[model samples]
Target: MNPNGPLLHFVIAAGLLDSFNPCAIAVLLIFIALMFTLSKNRSAILSMGFVYIMFIFLTYLAIGLGLLKIITIFSIPHLIVKIGAWIVIIVGLWGLKDTLFPGKRNILAIPIGSRQLIASWATKATIPAAAVTGILVGLTEFPCSGAVYIATLTLLSSSTTFLKGLIYLIVYNFMFVLPLIVLLLIAANRMILEKMINLDEMNSDRIRVISALIMIGIGIVILKWFV
Candidate 1:
């Protein structure tokens, strides 16, 4: 077996799971809703959605590449990875608490000010506005869904060459946006879009729990092997 196969599998799986980020999904839904209100043209809505997803993909890819470059340059110590692993675990636990307690405190959310800005951009319902919103959400939603990403980056730093890591980062970001792409496709159908929105709202807490578990598992795996 290729020695790196397990790591590659983990990266793909983490990327898929990370796509369920509540903040990202919420923002996309908000954009979709705003688009519906502003325009009756299906093509225009899809165009905006595509632009939004692409910008998010690009933004996240840039962040991963930048982080990888910094790690390579600084020769980030293994101890830091270990610490990061623990932090990931803690963040996962915090997510669970937030889910169960119904928001006693939510440190993982995008800031309210940033969310308002995103909403304002989304309300514009144009390709350029969507592109900007995507960039903003990509930057701001990290705290809400970054534990898995941090774990993936740590694993990539320790386990792969920089060139290979870059390839994985591209793949990862694509997977991160895959869900949005699906939503964008079905968004042309108002009924289906409404159903999806309702479903997401009903099970959001459950989804959060699942996401938290995955993060904790990834953290443990990193501590065991990669760190």
Candidate 2:
């Protein structure tokens, strides 16, 4: 199970960085409200988020399978360590860009922006923009698919069963929002959510920029030491 594994903090840190990213934050807040509107207890809220996160893990696992096929060709020594370092830096840069340009979104590619999907339960259907948003954020939030990401790929590749890797990935994802969830509670229910929604655009941008830079710097240190 790799209990007490080194990857624990690394994944948590990456998730945290992503959770706070401008795009990620926007989606997370929306999802929080979405889930709250649907069900409000901590358990219910977490369960809804789990459904969304599991969807992400399902897709990531599929990617892991595809990567397994690709890994064999260059499997002659994977540079898991180096790649992890690179991912850290790239993610940092991505955050830095958004922070500096608060109002603008840097994504240019087709998959860079939001996608629409229909979600249904018991014959009722609604636009599950938030779930889609959550899934997208989970996938792209990695600074760069580095050694950590690759090593995760490598582990999934080597495993006889995929559940092990998938479980780790899921846990890693949940930990990312622990802080924000806590912050939400401390703010006294969704009362302050309105304030978060109404935050001054420029001020919010500057805050994100500074936080993203700090996250990037931490990632560099991770590459240098931990990974």
Candidate 3:
């Protein structure tokens, strides 16, 4: 195996898990439905979707950089990573609980109170509306699905330089928004919205399980790295 294989695995896996966040996808689905209803032209909807994805990408990249800086400022970056790894483990366990006993409420998604707000904003569905909704979703969804991102940033803070870190962030964010881009394409083609929503609802639990597994795997790798 290549020397950087583990790092590559962690980054890509994290990005993929984050990308499949069901809560974010739910918001995106709603956004798409609203856009379809609000705008007559498919091109306008695509434009709005692109703008929304861009905001999410930029916001997440900025957040990652900010966290990376904080991690670097710490005197004991390795120790901090270890602690963060443990936190990631806990996060994974929580995800597992949600997956296994899905009815139980968890801290891994947007609050019920905020769902109404997100829906309200997304209902506007114009370019500016999409932009604002994108910012809101990106910021709000962080606490719900940010473990993989946090773990990755912590690891990178101690292990890589700034330019490399930026590149990794770019890759991660690209992967993060990829699913949304695809969904936008489907919507632009005027596919059945109800089917997509139904599909997401059916798989949301599985998404949680997969995310938990990947997070646990990353946590284990981090511990082994320290060993």
Per-model tally of clashing residue pairs: 0, 6, 0
TM-score of each: 0.91, 0.58, 0.89
lDDT of 3: 0.79
TM-score of 3: 0.89
- Model 2: what TM-score? 0.58
Choose the strongest candidate by TM-score. Answer: 1
Off by over 4 Å in 1: 1-4
lDDT, model 1, position 210: 78
- Model 3: per-residue Cα lDDT at residue 92: 88
**Residue 159, candidate 1: C-alpha displacement in angstroms:** 1.5
Q: Give one digit per residue, the lDDT tens place, for model 2 in 10-93.
A: 556654554454544454455656555665666655545555555554555455456555654454333644464465556556
Ranking by lDDT: 1, 3, 2
Model 1, position 209, has a per-residue lDDT of 84
TM-score rank order: 1, 3, 2
Worst 10 residues of 3 by lDDT: 1-10
Error of 1 at 60 (Å): 0.6
Question: Which pairs of residues collide in model 1?
Answer: none
lDDT at 132, model 2: 59
* Per-residue alpha-carbon lDDT of candidate 3 for residues 32-113, written as tens digits (9 for 90 to 100): 7777676557788788889988998888889999988888888777888898788888998988897787764765668777
